[model samples]
Target: LNPEARAFDASFEVLSVEEAVRVTGRYAPLADAVRELIEATILTEVDGGVVDNARAAIEGVTESLRQRTRSAKVSYRVDGRPLPLGNAAVGVCNPIAPPIVVHQEGGGRCWSEFVLGLAYEGPPGLVHGGVSALVLDHMLGEAASEGLSKARFTGTITVKYLRGTPLGPLRSEAWIERHEGVKVFARGTISDAAGVTVEADGVFIEPAWARDGQ
Candidate 1:
């Protein structure tokens, strides 16, 4: 490999298939528990006494975990491990997430499905605008690289709110419109039972390795 190729190789760390499998088995359930806890906390309306008791219990659990772990590790999508179970935001293994589900439809297109609970509420029965954007951004970013290359960073995204996205099972999709060099243009949509509620256009920059074919 030449210097340019070396740059790409040095930039990323890829773990062996065996190690990734073990990590996923160990952490996946723990992340699911955490996600459930987050949702419970958001919707709970317990009595004051119960709230206080719960808080104390939570503090004790936190302290116990603190003694075992130092800090959070930043985990990105790995080459062989297509499921990003370790991502902090929207990762299936992360409790602090909406944990959107994604499917690659091939041909630079992707599909996502998720249900937003009360924690994501914005207007009285509607999903928050920011939450909508987050989902769109995630979906579009995935679509931009689907069935294509691996540069998947969003440069910019513009969203249009056509109607209120209700709180329940929702669908999102995105497909690449075009690509110029390292830049990809993509379009995405969020819809509920009634129809499309939000639409977005985004620009995703492929990773440096993909650009140089390293």
Candidate 2:
């Protein structure tokens, strides 16, 4: 490949098809679970009927996923916070959305924030590497799922740990890089009083099934 092409490819942080397949397998169940919530809510007596059903479905899926996948999780929507789960990043953040806010997009791009707690320890008083990755993944994933771009799961994510994250308050941010066909590309990072501890790049897929308008 030419230097320009190589630079573009290098900039992408692309993954192999096999790698994409593997990630799809890992996250497909989560997507399906969300669909189930949408289906089940069809019969619920929501106030706005259609829109209310959609909200219930979204909230239900987030709650269900939080319960099953999160370790120690706490979440809140417009309503209020719910029972906390263990080891959950959102649960730890104390501001995570229950119906899993896809996309840090409350209003627009550039989503960011921080957290500090006892559980996310690594070196002395630093946050753990895995914990940093988890937070970045969810933040990136949220941006992916945002209505602006219909990204499903991360096809690939590359993270760099530039420094040790402090155990105190931390900040995180995620935003869309671009979109190609059914793929939505995004980037995110986590930082703290010390500095930028982690940087992340992600490719999110809209999924084959989602194309059917599901």
Candidate 3:
């Protein structure tokens, strides 16, 4: 074993790809957000029947942008900051991103501000409960990956609703919580213009596919 690579911590119950997808979707709101993000950002106007196909399109766009725009770095700084195009596209697939303003990014972390459209509304005027989870998951997942590196993907997530998150003018933040070797944890929150409304915790696994990258 290459001891320098990753010191063993604890092993978790490995969920098959299908099982993992199913488990995540149990929070239906998160699932829907993922679907939206995929359709809007990753796939763009192109219609691809499968996830991998969409990923390919995302890669093409990002690579093209990098090649055309970057100086010596082979990657241009969008909005005065490096943008992992594919990653951001994948990140925004979350319906929670809504159509609003994403803050100019810095380092590995990013923040977004937007209003929840009617499509995402739940509980009278408030955003749907699932939608909140979806937002947290998306941001947390992005934070887990940071830039260039693709995260293993979320394994488990724990969220505290706190107070009902409102639908409009919300701000969200994402950052890495901690990493126990292959497992990455991140924290994030949804807040109205007034104050924090909900908080979340996510456990992202550096899956075997990404182990080589680590």
- TM-scores for the candidates: 0.81, 0.52, 0.53
Q: Give stretches of model 1 more than 4 Å off.
A: 1-18, 70-83, 86-89, 147-149, 207-214
RMSD of 1: 3.7
Stretches of candidate 3 exceeding 4 Å from the true structure: 1-107
Alpha-carbon RMSD, candidate 3: 14.2
Tens-place lDDT digits, model 2, residues 1-214: 4232243242222445565456445664554454355445544665677876677777886777676542222221222212121214443223221222223445324555554454456777787788788887878877776633442777999989898888766677787778898998888888776667799999888765557533
Q: What C-alpha lDDT, on a 0 to 100 scale, does residue 173 get in candidate 3?
A: 86
lDDT, residue 87, candidate 2:
18
In angstroms, how far off is 20's CA in candidate 3?
31
| Candidate with best TM-score | 1
Residue-level error in angstroms, candidate 1, position 112: 1.4
Say which prediction, candidate 2 or candidate 3, comes out ahead on lDDT.
3
Query: How does model 2 score by TM-score?
Result: 0.52
Off by over 4 Å in 2: 1-87, 91-110, 147-151
lDDT of 3 by residue, 1-214 (tens): 2221233332223345565456435544553655466546633555447657867876886576466432322222333233322232232323434533344254447677766755677887788888888777777776787742454578999989888876667888878867798988888888897788989888888766456634
Task: At residue 42, give the lDDT of candidate 3.
Answer: 34
